[model samples]
Target: MTIQIRQFPCRRDNFGVIVHDDAGGPCVSIDAPEEGPIVAVLQREGWHLTHILTTHHHNDHTQANAALKARFGLEIIGPVRERERIPGLDRAVSGGDRIDLSGLEVEVIDTPGHTAGGISYYMPDEKLLFANDALFSLGCGRLFEGDAATMWASLQRLRSLPDDTMLYCGHEYTATNARFAIDVDPGNLLLQERVKEVEALRIEGKATVPVSLGREKRTNPFLRADDPGLAEAIGMAGADPVAVFAALRERRNGY
Candidate 1:
């Protein structure tokens, strides 16, 4: 059975997502950016809220947790490290844990760069990843709580997933990310093409998410730290991959 995913914008730049299993067993909300939009989507799709899988303790992601829980009596799952922080957290999970959402098996991955206790969920059967703020299209989350090395390690873990994995992130920051990517990797023809595509999409007010892991490997600066060309472009030739990644991240901060 195929998993059905519904992604919609909510709360300025954040995205609200709903994932439903084909067997009609469980319909899960990836995050609750806001109460009204999420509730509206559930009503429109005729999907009953069964679970709320939170990636971190950030307010924008968990702001609607309490309201949704009261409205639908849904199970709230979040990182074990952030159990005390995330609102409405019913089940605390960590890396290597497997959550069974009815018939679906969701693998928990530790991704703690964006936050001290960030987590990502991956469904192997569907090749889908709910990365939250850990990874983004042609970009990555800011190193808010973790250091560059720590974030690099987290990103490497996500990069190890199959190239075909469909990554659904938490925001609509692709246009800005693409701009920074092009500035740093101007010689990359693939990046050039991707920037144009991103520009066109944003012009149409369309979402540029659920990007393929393969495309990110080729075009995302954070994921391309090991590439010799990227290292040279950033004047960090022969530097360690992590160091190159750190340099790019620092540059992006000011970009």
Candidate 2:
């Protein structure tokens, strides 16, 4: 059976997600951004909470891990590399490991750059990616602990996913990301169209997440960093893809 998903705003820009097969089946939260909203969604949906799939040790992503575990006694699973930092983490996983949620396996992929221990969960059966801070709609996380080459490799792995895959991220930064993307790839017609849509959505106070991987591949400057045209747009033509990616990430840092 396909998993059902519920996404709602947590503290500030953070978004909390819960997935399950049915109301009676075991439910899993992607990250515990906050305890109150996570509990609110579970209670409102009448879904039985059983586990939490933590993406990283970042406070915005794992701040409620301990509190949620105490409230629900749910299993806390996180990146093995950050075991010492994730509060209440019961299981540590790494790239290539598969975790079970409602009888379906969630493939864990190591995605560093935002943080050295960052990981992303991919539900191949559902074609859903909980990208965390590693990759966003049109932007990505800042280079806090990892270098450009490392983050670029992680991003390439994500880009290799099926074009139809739907992406879900932790924050609501798409509106701003779209703006930066247009500045860097102004000639991209698709980006132009998507930016209009993003602006309208933000004006109405809507979430611009859960975008298609195909859309991101074509329009997101970060994902397109390896494209010669994208590199040329930023005056980095013929530059190594890693160098192009580094320039884009650096520019976004100040955007």
Candidate 3:
């Protein structure tokens, strides 16, 4: 049995994802940006939603939680730190907690940067990560509720995963992220090549998500703060990795 993933556009730039396990078990919704799109997808696929895994309390991510719960009678799980803010939350989990989605084991990772209580779900058996807004393709989420250092730490934890892990983020901001990455890492051939690909994909009205962790490590500026070439390009050679990361993030905020 193979894990099946379905991704669709929602709202302005948000993405809605559904992950189905192969053993005929629970089907999980990564976020609830909107109800109509998700409900339509579920009906089309004949998949009964058994769980809703929320990354944070952000409205765009959890706005349809209550509706989905009411419609499907599914359990709502979210970050323990943000339990009060997550509507229809049935279970609250923090980092290092293992949640059993039917027979599948989903590891809850506390990723606090995009939001103070942001969480990510990693399915080690499938090498798939539902990162939501904490990390993005060629970019990391804005430091809305935490500092750069805090975000950097969260990224480090995700970076430690196997290079082959498939990262499914929350938005369709890859094109813009690629442009900013190239501006900061001009000397990186990998980054240059990737930007071209991203541009072509966006031109065709395609989604540029579920990117490999290996590709991100090589080209994403947010993930390459420790690289000597990137540090040098940013005129911060030999500086602490976290400081370099902070500088890159600050520059991106203005870009």
- Tens-place lDDT digits, model 2, residues 161-192: 99999999999999889989999999999999
Candidate lDDT (C-alpha), each: 0.93, 0.90, 0.92
Instruction: Please give the lDDT score at residue 239 for candidate 3.
Output: 91
Report the Cα lDDT for candidate 2. 0.90
Q: What RMSD value applies to candidate 3?
A: 1.0
Where does candidate 2 clash, by residue pair?
Answer: none
Q: Report the lDDT tens digits of candidate 3 across residue range 1-255.
A: 467899999999999999887679989999899999999998998889999999999999999998999999999999999999999999999999999987878999989998999999999998999998988988999999999889999998999999999999999999989989988888889888999999999989889988899999899888878888889999999998999999988888998
The regions of model 2 sitting more than 4 angstroms off are none
Task: Give the Å error, residue 127, model 1.
Answer: 0.9
Ranking by lDDT: 1, 3, 2
